[model samples]
Target: MATHLITGAGSGIGAAVARRLHDRGDELVLVARDAGRARELAERFPGAGTLVADLAEPDRVSWALGHQTVPDRIDSLLHVAGVVDLGRIGELTTKTWHHQLNVNLIAPAELTRLFLPQLRAAKGHVVFVNSGAGLTAHAEWGAYAASKHGLKALADSLRNEEHAAGVRVTSVYPGRTASPMQAKVHSQEGKEYDPARWIDPESVATAILTAIDLPRDAEINDLTVRPGR
Candidate 1:
């Protein structure tokens, strides 16, 4: 069974990914901000380990990863942990922008940098859960769009750097998924967005797992999944 490490495994797309991977009998290392949720997930999968990490706090995140012992070789690294904030240029404060960028962009890149050696050893794949906003910006989504755009660029650059090293990278862009982040955005905007009409988190998880399961010689650099409206 392949071994994978997933960040933000506590809820939404991240939680769904963990559940599906566990069902497939893979060895899982789940990381999240909530210890209780992480523990609850670990209880469902035998041999699964949980690491409570606040990705925004790089020091704590680094200490958590550095102090832990995981499988020497990880077949896949899913950088799914992220936070979203909705605001126009002036409505968003520096703190909110920094917080969103910290979680959505910096954290994943830093984690990948810290774990690149192990991934190289295993010739593993790196999967990034980006957003459609990463490709095209939308109104009232300044910070989120900016952060996701930066994240996409990071993933693209990493894919190029790791191609020769036998490490594959895939960035997934899902448009309006049914996530807590989506709900928050809708609420903040007072928009009548239907969560049920959005892309399913489970389907996105399947896409991620499929990308990792692809033949080592094959590389899917980017994938975009949107609801069939």
Candidate 2:
């Protein structure tokens, strides 16, 4: 069984992906801000490990990594942790912008950097759980969009740099999904929350698994999933 490490695995898309991998008998390392939730997930899956961490803080990430007994080779590293704080340019605070970028971009980059040797050794895959905001900017999504755009660039660059090393990197752009984060976005927009109108987290997880299950001779560089209306 391959080992897969997933960030933000306590809830939403991250949790869905963890469940999918676990059901496939893959060993799991689940990282999340909620220690209780992460532990609960670990209990449900035999041989699963959990790391509680706030990805926004650099020191916390370092501590979390130090505490985990990472295998010498990892089959997949999935960056799924993110924050969505919406504000227009006029109302945006420096703290909010920095927080978004730190959690959404910097933390993932550092984690990937740390795991690169393991990934290369196993000829593994790296999946970035990006967003539709990364592809198209909206009025109140400037900060999030900027971070995701940076993520897109990071994924592209990593794919190029790691191709020779047998490491595959994919950027997944998923549309609005039913999650606590989307509920907050709906509240901010003054709109009714409609789960039917949103994409399902499981569907996105399936797309990720599809990328992971591809033949080592091939790779899926980018995947975009949108709700059918």
| Candidate whose TM-score is highest | 2
Q: Which ten residues in a row have the lowest lDDT in candidate 2?
A: 58-67
The sequence of per-residue lDDT tens digits that candidate 2 reaches over residues 1-229 is 8999898876789889988888878889877666777668778776888777678885567778787676677899999989999999899999999999999999999889988999999999999999999999989999999999999999999999999999999999999988888998999889999988898899999999999999878899999999976
Colliding pairs, model 1:
none
> Global lDDT for candidate 2?
0.89
lDDT of 1 at 40: 84
The candidate that achieves the highest lDDT relative to the unseen native structure: 2
In the order shown, the candidates' Cα RMSDs to the true structure are 1.5, 1.4
The worst-scoring run of ten residues by lDDT in candidate 1 lies at 64-73
lDDT of 1 by residue, 1-229 (tens): 8889998777789889988988878889887676777778778667798777778876567778676665677889999988887878978899999898988998898888888998999999999999999999988888988999999999999988988989999999988888887888788888877878888899899888789889866888999998876
